[model samples]
Target chain A: MRAVIMHGPGDVRVEDVDKPTLVEATDAIIRVTSTCVCGSDLWPYRGAQKSRGPARMGHEYVGVVEQVGDAVREVAVGDLVVGSFVASDNTCEICQAGFQSRCKHQVMMGSVGTQAEFARIPLADGTLVKVPGEPTPAQMRSLLAASDVLGTGWFAAVAAEAGPGKTVAVVGDGAVGLLAILAAQRLGADRIIAMSRHADRQALARRFGATDIVEERGAEGVARVKELTDGYGAHSTVEAVGTQESMMQAIRSTRPGGHVGFVGVSHGVELDGRDLFNATVSLLGGPAPVRRFLPELIDLIMADEIDPGAVFDLELPLEEAAEGYRAMDERRATKVLLSV
Target chain B: MRAVIMHGPGDVRVEDVDKPTLVEATDAIIRVTSTCVCGSDLWPYRGAQKSRGPARMGHEYVGVVEQVGDAVREVAVGDLVVGSFVASDNTCEICQAGFQSRCKHQVMMGSVGTQAEFARIPLADGTLVKVPGEPTPAQMRSLLAASDVLGTGWFAAVAAEAGPGKTVAVVGDGAVGLLAILAAQRLGADRIIAMSRHADRQALARRFGATDIVEERGAEGVARVKELTDGYGAHSTVEAVGTQESMMQAIRSTRPGGHVGFVGVSHGVELDGRDLFNATVSLLGGPAPVRRFLPELIDLIMADEIDPGAVFDLELPLEEAAEGYRAMDERRATKVLLSV
Candidate 1:
C-alpha cells in the first residue's frame, strides 16, 4: 500500500507501507477511495509546527469497508462509508452532547493515515456512517468532504449561532472557511462576510453564499466588519484561522452578546483575559465534533443539496502525494484531492 | 452630601462632597440607603490594580429616588428602586439582547459613586428597577444585593447553562460565587460543587445549596471535582475570581461541551489559546448585565424567596466607610454594607 508520510519540514512523500489490519474487536479495514490534503497539514510541512517523527498523514476519507472485526456491527465488507477524523464511541456523555471529538475513548484517525490503499478504523460501529448507496463520482468527492471539512464547517456555523437575522463574519479563506460560508448560508444567516485577500478563494466564498468580502486582516479586518454591521460588529463570527491575530479579530468582530466559533487548530495564540472579558462574547470551538453532523452532511451531499467538493481545486493520484502537500503549502491549491 | 473616596491604595475616606444633580435628560438622582464593599474593591485597595486618580468608591446600591430630569419617566421622586452598577438605555440592540451592561451608551455607576448620600443615575429608565413596595431592613439589604452581586451571580449561572440534571461547579467563594450556588440551585442543577478553603465561606456555600465542597485549589481542586463527577468534570462552572488560576480552574473543572460563566473583574489573567481549545468548553463571561435580571430578582427578594444579603456579614455607618474597606481588605468580612 502507498501512504503519505512526512519525513521533515517541507518534505512529504508517498512510499510503500504495510496495509492496515484490524487491531481491535471493533475495528474495520477501509480501502480508501478518496482523501485530501488539509490546511492543518501545511502547519507542520511549513515548520510552523514541530514534527515528532516521520508521521502518517491524512485523517479524512471516504472508503469501502474491506474487512470488519467481529464486534463491528454497523459497517461491513463492501459497504461504502464515511468517518470523522477522530474515532469516537458516539455513546459517551460528551459524544451524546455533540462533542464527539472529545469522546472518552477517542482516537485520532490521522495516526492510521487515511491517505493510503487501506486504513483501519477503530470503534467502527460508532465512528463510521454507512453511505446509503453507491455514490456518483461528484457525490463521492462530496462524501469525502463530509468526513471532515464540511462537517467541521457545519459545526463552526452551529457553534457561532449563525442563523436567521445574523450577520456572520468568517476569518479564514481556506477550504474550511469557504465551506463555513455555505453552512452559514444554509443555516439562514442574513449576511455572510468573507475576510479574504485572495481573488480565487474570495470568488469561491461568494459562490458558497458570502454576501460581502473584506480584503483586510487583523484590526483593520475587524474594523471593516464593524463598519458593515452599523458599528455593532457581526452577530456571529467563525474563526477558521487559529493564529493570535485571527482569534482576536473573531472575538472583536462580534457584538457584545454575539458568538465566536473558532474551528482552527490553535498554534501559538495566547488571549489576554481582560480582552476576552471586556469583549463579552460567547466562544465555543476546538476540534469540531464532525461525527455529530456526518449523517446529515452525507445526506445533503448525496441529495445534491450541497457541493462542498468544489473546494478541491487540484486532484492527483496517491503516488503524487508530495505534490499535493507542496501545492497546498505553497497556496497553489485550496484543497488537493487524492485518488486512493 | 457625603461620599466614599479612595485617596490612594489602602486609603479610603468619607468626606463632604457636592450632592449630584441631574445632568442628562434621562438622569435621576437617588438618595442612597445602602451600599456595600465588593471583592473587586479590594483590587484597587490592595494595589493589584493601578490607581486612576482619587476615585469615587462604590457602584452597588438600593435607594429612594430623589429627583428626575424631564425625560426620566420610569421612576418618580420618593420611589424606592434598585439600579445596576452600569447605566444603560436598555433600548439598544445589545441591551435588548439581555446584555445591558455592554450597551452602546453604558455608563459605569462606579464613577458616579453610589456610596454617597445622593448620586446621579444616567439612563434612569433603563438602569433603575423600582421595588414593588416598601421593604423591611432585611428586604432592603437583599434588594441592594440584587443591584449587583446577586444579579451578577444569576447571570453567571445562566451563562454556564445551569439547569435541571446539570452538575455545577463554582470557583471562588466570594459573594458572587456563593450567590451563584444559590442561583444554580434555583435553576435546578442536579448537584453543586463549591470550591473554597475558608470554613466560614464553605458553611455559607452549603447553606446556599452546595451539594459538595472541594477545599483544594488549582489542579488539585480540578482533580477533586473530576473525582466527584466520576472523572468527567462538571457540566457547568461559574468563575467568580478573575485570576489566572481561577479562570483555568473553572475551565478545567467543566467537561467538554460544558459551559464556564465568569463574572469577576479581570485583573492580570492571560489564557493560553491551546489550553482553551483543547479544553473544548464553552466560555462566556464579562461584567454582568445585571439590569437584565433586576426585575425578577426584585420580585424574589420582595417575596422573601431568597436571602442573598446574608453575604454582608459586616455592617458600618457612613462615617465608618474606611473601616468597611479595611474589614474586607483584611479578610475579616466577606462583604460589608454601608448605611449611607
Candidate 2:
C-alpha cells in the first residue's frame, strides 16, 4: 500500500508500506478514498515543528470500511465513513460534554496516517460516523473535509458564539479560517470579516459568506475590525492561526465580553496574563471536538447545503503526495485533496 | 475631609484633604458611610505593584448621596447606595452587553478614593445603585462588599458557569474567592470545593457553602480536584488569585469543557498558549463587571439571605485607616471595614 511518510523536515514522500491491520476488536480497517494536506502539516514540513524522525503523515480522510474487528458494531465492511483527527470514545464525560478531542480514552489518528491505501481506525464505533448515502466526487471531498477542517471551523464559530447580531472577525485566511466564515454565516452572524492579504483566498472567503475583508495584520488588523464595529471591536473573533500575533489579534479584535475561538494548533505562543485579563473576552479553543459536529456536517454536505470541498484547489494521486505538500507549503494551494 | 492616601509602598496615612466636588454633570458626591480594605489594595501596599507617588487607596464603598450633578437622576441626595469599583456609563454597548467595568466611559473609582469622608462618583446614573431602604450595619457592610468583592465573586461564579449539576472549585481563599463560594451556592452548584489552607478562611468558606476543602496548591490541588470529580476535574473553577500558579491551577483543575472565571488583579502572570490549548477549557476573567451583579446582590443582602459582610473580620474608624492597611498587609485580617 502507498502511504505518505516524512523522512525529515520538508521531506514528505509516498512509498509502498504494509497495509494496516486491525490490532483491537474495536478497530476497523478502512480503504481511504480521499485525504488531504492540512495547514497544520506545514508546521513540521516547514521545520517550524520538530519531527520525530520519519513519521506517518495524515489525519483527514473519507473512506470505505474494508475490514471490521468483531467489536466494531457501528461501522462495517463497505460502509463509507468520516472520522475526526483525534479518535475518542464518544461516551466519555468530556466527549459527552462536546470535547471529544480531549476524551479520556483518546488516540490521535494522525499517528495512524490516513494518506494511505488502507488504515486501521481504533475505537471505530465511537470515532467514525457512517455516511448515510453514496456521495459524488464533490461530496466525497466535502466529507473528507468534514473529517477535520469543516468540523474544526464549525467548532470555532460555535466557540466564538458567532450568531445573529454578531460581527465575526476571522484572523487567518487558511482553509479552516475560510470555512469558519461559512460556519459563522450558517450560525447567523450578521457580518463576517476575513483578515486576509491574499487575493485568491480573500475571494474564496467572500464566496463563503464573508461580508467584509481586512488585509491588515496585527494591531492594524484589530484597528480595522474595531473601525468597522463602531470602535467597540467585533462581537466575536476566530483565531485560526496559532502564532502569537494572530492570537493577540483575535483577543484584541473582540469587544469586552465578546468571545474568541482559537482553533489553530499553537506554536511558541505565550500570552501575557495582564493582556488577556484586561481584554476581558471569553476564550475557548484548542484541538476542536470535530466529532461533535461531524454528523450535522455530513448531513449538510450530503444535502448540498454547504460546499466545503471548494477549499480543495489542488488534487493529486497518492503517489504524488510530495507535490501536494510542496504546493501547500509554498501557498500555491489552499488545500490539496489526495486520491488514495 | 479625610482620606486614606498611599504616600508610597507600605506608607498609608489618613490625611486631611479637600472634599470632592462634582466636575461632570454625570457626577454624584457621596458621603462615605462605609468602605473596606481590599486584597488588591495590599498589592500596592506590599510593593508588588508600583506606586505613582501618593495615591488614593480604596475603591469599595457604601455611601449616602451628599450631592448630585444635574444629570445624576438614578441616585439623589441622602439616598444610600453602592457603586462598583469601576464607574461606568452603563448605557454604552459594552456595558449594555453586561461588561460595565469595561464600558466606553469608565472611571476607576480607586482614583476617586472611596475611603474618604466624601467622594465623587462618575457616571452616577449608571454607576450607583440606590439601596431599596435604610440598611442595618450588617446590611451596610454587605452592600459595601457588593461594591467590589461580593460582586466580583458573583461575576467569577457566573463567568465560570456554576449552576445546578456542576461541581465548582474555587482557587483563592481571599474575600472574593470565599464570596464566590457563596455565589456558586446561590447559583445551585451541586458540589463546591474551596482551595484554602487558612483555617479561618476555610471556616468562612464552609459557611458560604463550600462542600469540600483542598489545602493543596498548584498541581496537587488540581489532582485533588480531579480525584474528587472521578478524574474529570471540576465543571467550573474560579481563580481569584491573579498569580501564574493560581491561574494555571484553575485552568488545570477544570475538565476539558469546563469554564475558568478569574477575577484577581493580574500582576506577573504569563500563560503558555500550548498549555491552555491542550487543556481545552473555557477562560473568562478580568476586573469584573461588578455593576452588572449589584442590583440582585443588594436584594439578596437586604433580604438577609446571605451574609457577605462576615468577610469583614475587622473594623476601623476613618482615623485608624493606617491600621486597617497594616492589618490587611500583615495578613491579620481577611478584610477590614472602615466607618467614615
Candidate 3:
C-alpha cells in the first residue's frame, strides 16, 4: 500500500508501506477513498513542527470499510464512512458534551495515518458516520471535507456563537476560515467579515456570503474590524490562524462580551493576560470536536445544501501525494484533495 | 468631607477633602454609609501597581442618595442604593447585554472617589440598585457586600456556568472567592472546591457551602483539585485572584469544555497561548459587570437567603479608614468595611 510519509522539512514522499489491519475488537479496516491535506499538516511539512524520524501523515479521510472486528456496530464492511481526525467513543461523558476532541478515549488518527491505501479505525461504532451509500463523484469532495475542515469550520462557528444578529469576523484565509464564512452565513449571522489579503481567498470568502472583506493583518486588521463594527468590534470572531498576531487580532476584533472560537493549531502564541482579561470576551477553542457535527454536515453535503468541498482547488492521484503537500505548502492551492 | 487617599505605597490616610456635588445631568450625590477596601486597592498600596500623586481610593459602597441631578431617575434623594465600582448609562447596547462595566458611557467610580463622605455617582439610575428600604445594621453588611464582592462572585459563578450537577472550584479564598462558593451553591452545583491555605478563610468557605477544601497553592493546588474531580478537573472554576499562578490554576482546574470565570483584577498574569489552546477551557472574566447582577443579588440578600458580608471580618470608622486599608494590606483581615 502506498502511504504518505515525512522524512524532514519540505520533504514528503509516497512509498510502499504495510497496509493497516484490524488490531482491536472495536476496529474496522477501511480502504481510503479520499483524503486531503490540512492547514495543520503544513506545520511539520514546513519544519515549524519538528518531525522525529519518518512519521505517518494526514488524518482526514472518507473511506469504505473493507473489514470489521467482532465488536464493531453501526458500521460494517462495504459501508462508506466519514470519521473525525480524532477518533472518539461518542458515548463518553465528554463526547456527550460535544467535545469529542477531548474524549476520554480519543485517539489522534494522524498517528495511525489516514493518507494511505488502508487504515484501521478504532471505536468504529462511535467514530464513523456511515453515509447512505457510496457518494457520487460530485459529492466526494464534500464528504471528505466532512471528515475534518467543514466540521471544524462548523465547530468554530458554533463555538463563536455566530448566528442571527451576530457580526462574525474570520481571521485566517485558509480553507477552514473560508468554510467558517460559509458556516457563519449558514448560521444566519447578520454580518460576515473575512480578513484576507489574497485575491483568490477573498473571492471565495465573498462567494461564501462574506458581507465585508478587510485586506489587512495584525493591528490594522483589528482596527478595520472595529471600524466596520461601529468601533465595538465584531460580535463573534473565528481565529483560524494560531500565530500570536492572529490570536490577538481575533481577541481585539471581538467586542466586550463577544465570543472568539479559535481552532487554529496554536504555535508560539502567548496571549497577554491584561489584554484577555480586559477584553472580557469568551475564548473557546482547541482541536475541534468535529465528530459531533459530522452527521449534520454529512446531511448538508448529501442534500447539496452546502458545497464546502469548493475549498479543494487542487486534486491529485494518491501516488502523487507529494504534489498535494507541495501545492498547499507553496500556498498555490487553497486545499488539495487526493483520490486513493 | 473626609476621604481615604493613597499618598504612596504602604501609605493610606483619611484627610479632609472637598465634598462632591452633582456635576452632570445624570449624576446623583450619595452620602456614603458603608464602603470597603478591595483586594485590588492593595495592589497600589503594596507597590505592585504604581501610585502617581495622592489618589482617591475605594470603589465599593452602599449609601443613601443625598442629592440628585436634574436627569436622575430610578434613584432619588434618600433612596437606599448599592452601586458597583463602575457607573454606566445602562441604556447602551453593552449594558443591555449585561456587561455594564464595558458600557459606552462607563465611569469607574474609583475615579469619582467612592471612599469619600459624599460621592458623586454618574449615571446614577443605571449604576445604583435601589434596596427595598433602609437596611438594618445586619442587612447593611450584606447590602454593602452586594455593592461589589458579592456581585463579583455571583458574576464569576454565572460566567463559569456553575449550575445544577456541575462541579465548581474556586481559586481564591478572599471575600470574592468565598462568596463564589455561596453563589455556586445557590446556582445548584453539586460540588464546590475551595482552594485556600488559611484556616479562617477555608472555614468561611466551608460555611459558605464549599463541599471540599484544598489547602494547597500553585501546581499542588491544581493537582489536588484534579484528584478531587476524578482526575478530570471541575466543570467550572472561579478565579478570584489575578496573579498568573491563580489564572493558570483556574484554567487547568477546569476540565476541557468547562468554564473559568475570573473576576480578579488581572495583574501581571500572562496566559500562555499554547497551554490555553491545548486545555480547551472556555475563559470568561473581567472587572465583573457587577451591575448586571445587583438587582438579583440585592433580592437574595434582602430575603436572608444568603449572607456574603460575613467575609468582612473587620469594620472601622470612616475617620480611621487608614486602618481598614492596613488590616487588609497586612492580611489581618479577609475584608474591611468602613462606616462613613
Candidate with best lDDT:
2
Residue B180 lDDT in candidate 1:
96
lDDT by residue (tens digit), candidate 1, A1-340: 8889999999888898998888999999989999999888889998999896899999999989999999988888999999999999999999999999999999999888888888999999999999997789999989988888999899999999999999999999999999999999999999999999999999999999999999988889999999999899999999998999999999999999999999999989999999999999999999999999999898988899999999999999999999999888889999999998
lDDT of 2 by residue, B52-129 (tens): 789887999988898999987788898998999999999999999999999999999998888899999999999999
Task: Please write out the lDDT profile of model 3 over residues B1-340, one tens digit for every residue.
Answer: 8999899998899999998888998999999999989999989999999787799999999889999989887987889899999999998878988999999899998898778788999999899889996566878999898888998999999999999989999999999999999999999999999999899998999999999999888889899998998788899999999999899889989898999999998888877778988898899999899999998888888888898889889998988888888889879999999998
Q: Write the per-residue lDDT of candidate 3 for residues A202-266, one digit (tens) a residue.
A: 99999998999999888899999999988889999999988988899999999999999999999
TM-score for each of the candidates: 0.99, 0.99, 0.98
Winner of 1 and 2 under DockQ: 2
Q: RMSD of candidate 1 to the true fold?
A: 0.8
Give native contacts recovered, as a fraction, per prediction.
0.88, 0.91, 0.74
lDDT to native, each model: 0.93, 0.94, 0.91
* Worst 10 contiguous positions by lDDT, candidate 1 chain A: A133-142
**Local accuracy of candidate 2 as per-residue lDDT tens digits, A78-114:** 9999999999989999999999999999999989998
Which residue runs does candidate 2 get wrong by more than 4 Å?
A: none
Considering just chain B, what TM-score does every model have? 0.99, 0.99, 0.98
Q: What does the lDDT come to for candidate 2?
A: 0.94
RMSD (Å) per prediction: 0.8, 0.7, 1.1
